[model samples]
Target: MKKTISREALKSASLEYNDVSGDFNWIKKRRGPIKVGQKAGSINHAGYVVIKIDQMKFMAHVLVWFLKTGEWPTLDIDHINGIKTDNRFQNLRHVTRSVNLQNQRKAHPNNHTGLIGVNKKGPKRFLALIQIDGIQKSVGTFENAIDAHNAYIEAKRKGHPGNTL
Candidate 1:
């Protein structure tokens, strides 16, 4: 059977080392090199010597650590807000590769139909399209970029169930 350690037990247990700092405390043995845990190779929480904290799985915890500690993470934490670093739990959302691509912003100049809308055979006019769940959906065509973007947003809201679009 799998063994589960209670939070109280973990709290009372002696912590030999703190990954945040190089110092070691507790126990009679002098400070020495800490042995890496069995789950050390796992990404997200690999650096910490204690409990595993998977930022991808538990984004709220990641935001809490950042907000309370003011430590910037090395990895890119994208918020579903279209704003890359909002980090608010309500605004934060887990996204797959395709879904993330669907939410990407428009590319720079010279890149037509890269975002905002899809270009037709004609010039200036564009069709707003959003791909969700591997299905391509055309929102509608418009004369202006903003109109196309708005259409895309509306379509996104419709496509994603229970999504705070």
Candidate 2:
């Protein structure tokens, strides 16, 4: 189970907030004997920051939302820039999983076609596809990857609002 902190409890924790970095430094050590004003938590293997409060561990992004809003986020906290470690308050927003996925980076590690949604269909043919609401729709096949990608982008713009190529 995930641990959530209330705004009052967070205030009681005596953490100092860095306006520039949007990170909370522990001013008062709760259970651990650590120096005051030291940056709290460490980046986990998944790249998200984790802070330990008492015996419970919480994600720093979620904690930041609670601190700023005085309420827990009912939906996922998405990093607007798509960088996991950039926890600046301005870079964060509460969004649904689908909307969050729409704002993701264009290419993944396995992308070899150099364009998002464009893949090699054959030696000389490229296929463009887009997924909307968990359903994959084919844009069209093209002789060049760029053309296929263009079709994919057009389809994406029409299907998704506020989407950027």
Per-residue alpha-carbon lDDT of model 2 for 28-110, expressed as tens digits? 75665767888888899978888877568888888888888887889889887777777888888898877777776566768
Q: For model 1, which pairs clash?
A: none
lDDT of 1 by residue, 57-156 (tens): 3233243334434553444334565654333445444445445455556554665756554554357787777777777878887887768878877887
Question: lDDT for each of the candidates?
Answer: 0.48, 0.81
True-structure lDDT of candidate 1: 0.48
User: What TM-score does candidate 2 reach?
Assistant: 0.80
Best by TM-score: 2
